[model samples]
Target: MREEPVKTKNANRLRDERRNQKDTRNGGEQTVLTEMDGIKNAISDVLEQLLNAEFKKFVWHLWNGVGADIERIPRAALENADRQDVVDRMVQKYTTNAGTVAVQVLLNINQNDLAKQLEVKLQKASSQRKGSALLITNIRFDKSSQRSGAEIDEENMEWLLGALGYSVEKHTNLSGEEINTAVSNFSKRYEHQCSDSTFVVIMSHGQRIQNKDAILGVHYDPNEHPDDIFFVEDIFSHLNSVSCPALIDKPKVILIQACRGDVCAFRDPTNGSFFINYIVDMFSTSAHKYDIMELFRKIASRMQNDPRFSQSKKLLPCIERTTLVKKFYLFPGLMK
Candidate 1:
């Protein structure tokens, strides 16, 4: 083969050996390790382990196009891509179909930090329920008031919490000041110092003031006086790790079955409050051994899916600041 004469400018690189490892022998295309390439390598390393068969299974029910995308580009194809484009096709696929599944599946992966955190939460919940207590403040007005069908919720909560093996303290018709005192005194209980967890249920009418959510006592009427309301923050702050050191590492299980603001759902007007109905229905059949959050998730799911309210109303319980430092279980062994 005749050697072709190299141009002077191009020959300088070969003579000086200054051009970085490019050679024309085998269609020379050198891979450069840029900062972005490093990041891509790191991310791909993590994602290769994350987007496994387990994750695909975890979100099979939630994601819309995951199955189709996985089918369109076979796993074998993804495995055979060049280094740079290995994750590129996948990134495009997930972006096009939306990544709701990818994000949610991160929480359930067995070895990921999120799944480990949830495991810690589960550990705190898995202990025996022999010592915990559920304090329920059930306040339905004395016949003269307009709110009805609330007493049914009070009864149902007792039966459910009792079945969970929580020693129940039922307080009826407490005034605003009395509610404060009841909760304040409850926070100082000797049992909390040694108990695994505590459950507080306050069923009443509530309205927000200056954007702060507050629960109303039976005395609250159209006047809306401050004395007749107990701010929800007070409940949380009162039982916080600082105020009540006894509950420092314990789960403060709170369920407020109250109307926040005036957001009312059109119901049968006789069956019951929408939130309570779902709560009772779900808790009645709660799993014998599982996390309390599982029961909570079920209630939220049913509330969103219930035919009557799905279009009109959507309700989710406000779960906050579980500083238990571990997972918890409310394995109330029987459905009483």
Candidate 2:
């Protein structure tokens, strides 16, 4: 007679048996489709894509539950909670199913794309390296030529570059030769091989010599024996396709926030220069939605409409040169 067929257990049989026993003790069946941490992270990430007002609306809808199975959380409990706090509360209330509930809230708020993003699990999309940026700012100069508020521009630019996923190589108060060397070295960096684009931002006192834009170095002085200045054209030469093969076919943005006058650039004592400030504002608000050219147009439009230009009509941030083959969007927070 054949022996009774012996039962075989899989590798996770012991663990599943223990889980079943624990569920039995709780008097309910609990199936964990996604881990608690993963649920919280996905919900938090998707919620952050919403604007401030949209975020507030999302929080309100989340609390109301509207037509969902989630429990009605109190307003006072979430009134002071931030985004992370809300994620925590959602996960705590719904356990491993918070991702689904959060997706529903996003849909209710008309953020359908974001809702879809949350519904579909995402894996790492790119293994390429993050982009790189070169920032050169000259604030102080000889003969008491302190750029009263240039530091603000440096700080703001650094933050903006960082937010766009570019590791910024910042140089402050460098001489002309030093600035050139910095750019040359930056162009050779291996990061550009994997990066999609790069930025070269130079801010300083500027003057037009022989119809060429040049930024005055920190040591430059009108009466000085030797002039210390870096021609803006040389920057293009260093990062051009011939010189920087790594950046070939990539969008290279060159921003020169300096005046063409013989004297120092216009700047606020506390706030930075108008050009840099406008750049920060426009990029911060619209970079995610619009391309670089569109953003430049918006900035120019703002400058043209400024009340300050009503009298002189002189200072305006214009795109000096652009060699972009296609549109470039920052798509902030999408990478990294």
Candidate 3:
């Protein structure tokens, strides 16, 4: 992960400024705060500007459901409901890659108690703790590479991950066997073994397996001929419960930025592919306000608006498996 020395310095400076802003009359103590409060305060900027004035009300109504008045509910039950549990009850989405649900809905559900828990977690800043690592296999093929745009995408990813304090390991242009070795070895790394979560990113030229939807890598043997590419499922096979015990309860994020087929849609010689562009765009503005799936939805919405998209159908980004028990946040600290 690369950083601009100045951005880090500036962000830290701003953070310090806010901390010492002196909200109270007596300078005896700095302003008190919590993680959940911080998150809600940050997102309030977006919510305040919402065009649909009644969106929050509607989400709350939906949460209350067809019956069961809020008036009758006991305070004890409300006090006990956690944010993660509240999220599970409020939204019914694909078990795999159900992505982040609406922040508005989250704020509306048991708003007091859940926020308190999240606030505590946030202030602790556990996401940026040591031992956490991110693995990236950025394949810009040596000969038939993904173009200069891909390089920019790699830089962007590094910055984003770095900002979140991830010790990012990037492996570029690997063969099928090498890719397997890299991941197999990574799963065993001592750093990740002690970490709370992991992210695996693969970018390459890929093809769909015959009659199947699995993505295949651009692996070619020394004979100067194409060979068996990786089966995308192998990603999970290597990291799932029985296979990689270290990541059993931890969040394992897999993002594939490869071309799924031989087709090309709206790619720019300067800006790069649609996926990479929107990825940066979404993450650049996102401040832990939405989950990875919710972020993907934002990307999907933007892709739908592409000038050439309606004319030339765009490929959808695969959700793969989203067996996350709790929502994950990159929680980038300060970008360089």
Pairs that clash in candidate 3 = 35-119, 36-119, 97-322, 99-293
After aligning candidate 3 to the native by TM-score, how far in Å is the CA of 3 from where it should be?
A: 29
lDDT of 3 at 313: 64
Candidate 3 residue-wise lDDT at 326:
69
Tell me the TM-score of each prediction against the true structure.
0.55, 0.64, 0.56
Candidate 1, residues 1-336: lDDT per residue as tens digits? 100111112111111121133333355433212222333444354445554465454433223333443434455545434434544654455442222333334454444664444334333333335444545443464322345545555666666566555778778777677788888888887877667678888876666767877777767654554467788778887888787898876677787766566654222224445565565544444343335677777877766675543464455566666554454655432112
Give a tens-digit lDDT track for model 2, residues 68-145. 456777787789788999988877777766777777788888999998888764221121225889999888777535
- TM-score ranking from best candidate downward: 2, 3, 1
CA lDDT of 249 in candidate 1? 62
lDDT of 3 by residue, 121-197 (tens): 44454334343444444434543444445555566666555545567888776777677777777787778676767
Off by over 4 Å in 3: 1-146, 210-224, 262-266, 332-336
| TM-score, model 1 to reference | 0.55
lDDT of 3 at 229: 61
By TM-score, the best candidate is 2
What is the clash count of model 2?
0
Deviation from native of the Cα of residue 241 in model 1, angstroms = 2.2
Q: Judging by lDDT, tell me the better candidate of 1 and 2.
A: 2
Clashes of 1: 10
Task: Give the range of the ten consecutive residues with the poorest summed lDDT in model 1.
Answer: 1-10
